[model samples]
Target: MTRTLSRAACIGGGVIGGGWIARFLLDGTDVAVHDPHPDARRIIGEVLDNARRARARLISAPPVPEGRLSFHDDIAGAVEGAEYIQESVPERLDLKHEVFAAIEAAAAPGALIGSSTSGFKPSELREGATHPERIFVAHPFNPVYLVPLVELVGSGPQDEAILDRAADILARTGMHPLKIRREIDAHIADRLLEAVWRESLWLVKDDIATTQEIDDAIRFGFGLRWAQMGLFETYRIAGGEAGMKHFIDQFGPALKWPWTKLMDVPEMTEELSAKIAAQSDAQSGQHTIRELERIRDDNLIGILHALRANGWGAGETLRAMEERAFAQAHARAAHAAPDPAAPLELHRAKVGGDWLDYNGHMTEFRYLQVFGDATDAFLGHIGMDADYRAQGLSVYTVETHIRHLAETGAGANLTVRTTLLGFDAKRIRLHHEMVDGAGTVQATAEHMLMHVDTQAGRACPMGAPLTERLAALAPGQSALPAPDHAGRPIRDIGWPLGEPA
Candidate 1:
């Protein structure tokens, strides 16, 4: 029997490290923590609780089914044989080198080693390491469990493969991994954000704006747009007629203006620091950091949850999450995969005694048969019926792809979701993801259908009335193909279909 790689190790066990542990464990990966502090386990447990609560807002799916956590007193013991090692110790250069030495010695040679240093560049962190190629910066935002972005930067060729694997694992943990083109201090996002931080510090030091006011400026203004689409793209739309170049041409001269003092560093004088700290305390005296953390979590959940509805970035995260939850629930209930939530109408055949083959599960071809029935039903619902076909109007399947993931044995009741991908004057495209009642995706179908005129027995344009009707149905889905299937096919599967429907 082959064992799944679900265990990971975190070294140092401080705030950020504890967060990495929380994120991994909450995402269904068993985690081991290594920290010399005698209170490491307690601290990590608290962090995980916070992380879990924060994750609650963003993920509506069931809890990650909980995973085991082990505390290792020894660093080598924690890293030994682990598939991935996340090093999140304090960001001191010397300390990172010291820790990496041990990590290199203990972690499996093939294991990816990620250093959670917000300040140190990958080259600098891996300077003295024997496994330089395997060590890279995996800088995550503070409060790692809530934030979805990770900045991956490294120099060596092996770094790409390791980072790609890390991206998969991070996606599993519900994070967005962006691989940086070059090794730079503070990676990508932090660098862009650092400029604002520096200016915010200046404003505070000069008494130009209150912290709350700066926050208000962001929240009430461009912040919301930036959350969905970042700076350049947002600005390009704002540029009007000619787009990006026109906008740049009009605004390029502003770059030379003294609107920003980015190069100016703020002095952390005792008086200035004291004043800032006092103002921060005054601004949030009503709540503790724990309370603020809860608020942040709620906001993240709201924002990401809303985005998930549209199948955006954070929304995709939610879909991925819901799939896992549905999968786990089905496992526990020992039921077959059924239909997930969909906008279109769907139906499924219950698993009968004869549905099971010699392996005691539904066979592969049964998926096609069931889905074919579903397609027929859906087309019938949407003005495509025997009469319409007799008039030379029908849907032709141009392409299909199915995946078998799990087995649905005899006596297992199953359901499916059929979604209208889009429709045009000439053709219709549809997608179906079959899941259990618990919401696990079992199989998916992407179908390209051409409307045919029965009299000519060939493809024909869809009537305006029918197109208008479909517009009322799928809405915006008709404009373009989904991001995953752009310019490629009439239809293609998005999720794996396990066994049978």
Candidate 2:
């Protein structure tokens, strides 16, 4: 199957489907979504809200607006012409089978169908489908829009290639897509999660610890290590330069002891589920889902930013992010102004850590923040400083659009360049570009800012004095060399910030 994607479908508009939308749309793929549940629209809208926040948290530099999201009442409407179909309905086997059947009937022959069921094997999911080979499993963690890992399992002929395609697509979604060798009940990641969960259940059942205690044990301990390097590599280092062989030799014998019950699978009694759910509620009784999502996005951004600082798995993610930011900044800067004498100071700013998202790049809002700062600085330079504002005057951005051309990583030196697009008595239209130390433009902000009176908080005219300064500045202002497509403001999708000749 062709790897290039145009449209994708998320068949369920719940949390998981919303995540799929977040992943694909943030990465620039058009998405069609369907859900029969009465609250699907509201649920997906909530998901999109979370997705916007998630994108802002992880992707430094603004991500392109999600490709058009078409909500459909019928499954066929969502699946038609979609290159990929992600099924994220409830966790019932029968329901998944029915959904897969519908997907098979609706999707084109080339489209790949992915089931987000955590426990079901692909063989079982494909049991009733006509083209079982096109179907597989793509199990993502909760708060799927933020977490990058997706456990992919494929069955039947050419399964490996299908899995590869899925992995590529997930990578484009900024996820760490893992392909397990064969089918298992819960696949590799969840199996690891299950092992810990089962042990946790045993602890809770035996009154050894509470739910939060188990969570603290993992989170405060090995979870930190696992994010950068997997368990085996960490253990190898823990072996003191003896390497994997020596490490295994020294500790392998402990496997025979009663350190863990490796073969145990806990029974999912209602009592156990209720106990877990109750504990979860007790832990987070006051926070709404949106609030929880913001918290998660904040923590993930912090952790990932730290990882990027140390050059971990998040580092690669960061590099990709920085490149993107530079590209967009360059594009926006390029189109903004007509020609000028020297570099225009759009804003002088400080970078914040919160601007770093899960991908360890700058967030979308910060890009505008920086651009706005740059514009303020330029206006100040041209005699629109606070003193000017002290006389009941300031600038307020009324309309703005940002285009993300490349990714930007944490701690990369970036500066904003402003080009005076045009100006009127009451408003100034400007373009701002953020560039890294290496002179790569990552993102651009085009804003329509209105003059305002600080005291009245209402629109005001640019005085004759400020207007003269703007004209003086405008004569010296010039846009950057046009990128490949000069006539259009938007650039090629996912285009790189090319090396300067």
Candidate 3:
């Protein structure tokens, strides 16, 4: 089944739970939410709006139809038919236990339960529970829809299957499911965060740095390194010809030196809290919370795109998701029997804000990207796939001519209507019309393609279904009227000799 997430229930719809909801729904999972907060619906709606914008920019895959969103009066109603349940209520032992009881009472049998607790252990959350084995920690970072990591922890060895299943479900939704080996008080990331937080508080309390200055230290320095490579991995490079052991040997003793006050947490007096709050306000007071979130989302998208180019770290995860999305699209197309007689519509996509340039229309390069994707979709329509390419035969673009017909704005839903101009044994001449949702032509491209034996690095005749499929479609496609500019090149606009000389 392609549906990894059929239904998900969120017990709380604050920032974290709201993110979980958006992540699930945008991945095409129906979600039911329960929160007693009077403004629960509005809060979730606002978060969903932000998530929608971020996803449009962050992911280029035409999003699957969003899953249905519903709010329930109580937790029981929310968890009724849910296959996955995430709890993100306020942190407390008794409250969690009570919620777990309510959830387990009505949740489907064997449905997975994950707690978003930052401090409580799985063992603690499992206490007095009906299905204690099902409960585990699925803690995520803030702005959870965009940040992919969900630190998964179980109490002991009993949850290997549960962990694997949970990880699979998360991976399908484009999340990196990191399984923790053992249960600790706050799990892995939060523990590390606590250490950093303690040191930062001390820095602030001693007036060593203002909030902005402290933030600058991170944003300008190791934070970038930490993003793609974590602490030890980044430091291994710091060893310079030597490795981790050498770096540790050189810098390990510094750990023993009294250069930090990690153990001694500063007292949380009224004065210190006020000082920290005032400094934070002064530093970022110009932007509202939502505005800051948008900036962060944009920055994260840039970083992710960079990492994806290199195929390292989180970028690898993103690439895998993109591959999966494309494969799914191809699969759906393959299953369908679209009329080969008509203009074959194999691909469509929405123009997100990221696709726009300074002129507020889709950028120049993205048009080619869209046409290229449509070309792939066409190849897939004729049964080209990874398996076929593995045989060292593939299609390559030899030449292309594009005419920008109209300026398309952001949020325009684009559909590529492809026509087969002509074809030979080794060459396929194709034409593509890029149209917006309203049927206006935004652009058109004429491409000459050559099938090649990848290993031989030369043109080759296509075999089997590809040729057969093309022959089958040629009858109808060949009869269609050709565009006047199909074989034309850019018009020469040489300046008049006398104008400037």
Candidate 4:
């Protein structure tokens, strides 16, 4: 939806790189990927499938058309003509240097190069680079597409501009790009995670808690709080009437109470590794890795939806993305806005797999959703937008009639054709025809929409822009023949004719 790079190159096809590919492609940027693994294509395909499912559920705004995907066997072929190149090979510095060299040789001159290195600083990543300024650290958490936090660490003062540009690009693609002030090993989030990881390993080695117990301690406790508020804000609230200062005063002593073994290095002996692995296997071995990924994605989608509704934390990023998505959809439909003489075809959608009912057809409610979206599109076509709504003016649908004409299935592409039957100073009567890809009418909806002053909670007379626009189109639309079903009400059938008598 946001203006993305013309082309993006991913130098690896493992989990993290594949996630980058998914985000870029779904945001409507052509992606070129290079991965040497024997089964790279299959692995990337699986991740993409999951990403698509997540996108369908998580995004409420109009969908962006998916971009092209191409796989290359070599870095030179992949990075050619790419405006943004991401390196996600193994963590070894030597391997990264080789990859960077190849990328530098073939990538476009002004391409932004980012490394998905968790522990390496940007300076270390740029050690032997030809265009060092273009290279930086863009560390992301696991399941990069859904989680949305991208730690963008730049190496020097010159890198400020580049990192800012990188942040802009990522933010447009529905990510929160946290720009680090300076280069540091392991960056920010991972450093905090490492402390907890070390302490958890100690807790297990001491037999104080099993793997499942430790996970429950986090997931059932502070993990929920951290998802929305993070550490400091949650503690600030715990301060009650006092503030963060009081919280620090109360817990500062705990920092030296030897409550954690964060500084101690646990010898990862074969026995210790096996003990942890076996406990983890027992805890979650019921599901395969793919199944577990899907479960995680679904949970994250729900949480994101809640956060979006509340407009808090990472949800703000999601909100911004949805806004951009709406704007982008409006821009795409700009060309399709018909002359008042012709029926407007401004809304289109493809039924997702999640839209199906138990009967293997599209669910009843989804039909309503499509028609509602179509109505919204028609409103937007005239000039309604966020700024217009901010003036406490909006059109509310007062009545509607629907006729289901045919069964709809998952993945069925639908288009809505709308006609303005009549409009007074305050209200509009509109009709929508929902048709499938084959041009068969699937459903029809008629609605009476009233313009209202939201703050006053009452219907109001129309103003300049809306009144003028409506008047301009009234002649053409009013003169055209109206739908046969227009203004019709539900017909009554006598109880089986003679049965009731």
Highest TM-score model number: 3
lDDT of 4 by residue, 1-501 (tens): 334677999999899999999999999989999999999999999999999888878886678888899999899999999988999999999999999999999888999999999999888888878999999998887788888999999877888888888988888889999998888889999999999999999888889999999999999999999999999999999988899999999989888897877778789999999999999999999999999999999999889989999999989989888887776675565435478887788888889877898999989998888888788777766666676778999899999999999999988899998888888989988989999999999999999999999999999986666777677778878877888988888776567864543
lDDT rank order: 3, 4, 2, 1
Clashing pairs in 4: none
Residues 46-115 of candidate 3: C-alpha lDDT, one tens digit per residue: 9999999988777666566789999999999999999999999999899999999999999999799998
Model 3 spans with C-alpha error above 4 angstroms: 1-3, 390-392, 463-465, 491-501
lDDT by residue (242-341, candidate 1, tens digit) is 8999999999999999888798988989988998888888788799877887777777777877887888866776677666554443233222222223
Residue-level error in angstroms, candidate 2, position 308? 2.5
- Indicate the residue-level lDDT of 371 in model 2: 73
| Worst-scoring 10-residue span by lDDT in model 1 | 333-342
Task: Go through the candidates in order and give each one's C-alpha lDDT.
Answer: 0.73, 0.75, 0.89, 0.88
The runs of at least 3 residues in candidate 4 whose Cα sits more than 4 Å from the true structure, single-residue gaps closed, are: 1-3, 337-345, 353-365, 380-398, 403-413, 424-427, 435-442, 451-485, 489-501
> Who is ahead in lDDT, 1 or 2?
2
Prediction RMSDs, each to the true structure: 15.9, 15.9, 2.6, 3.7
lDDT of 2 by residue, 229-333 (tens): 988889989888778889889989998888776577567799878888888788787899789877887888777777767777865666555445434444443
lDDT of 2: 0.75
Candidate 4 TM-score, true structure as reference: 0.88
**Which candidate number has the best lDDT?**
3
Assess the local accuracy of residue 242 in candidate 4 as a C-alpha lDDT between 0 and 100: 92
- Winner on TM-score (1 vs 2): 2
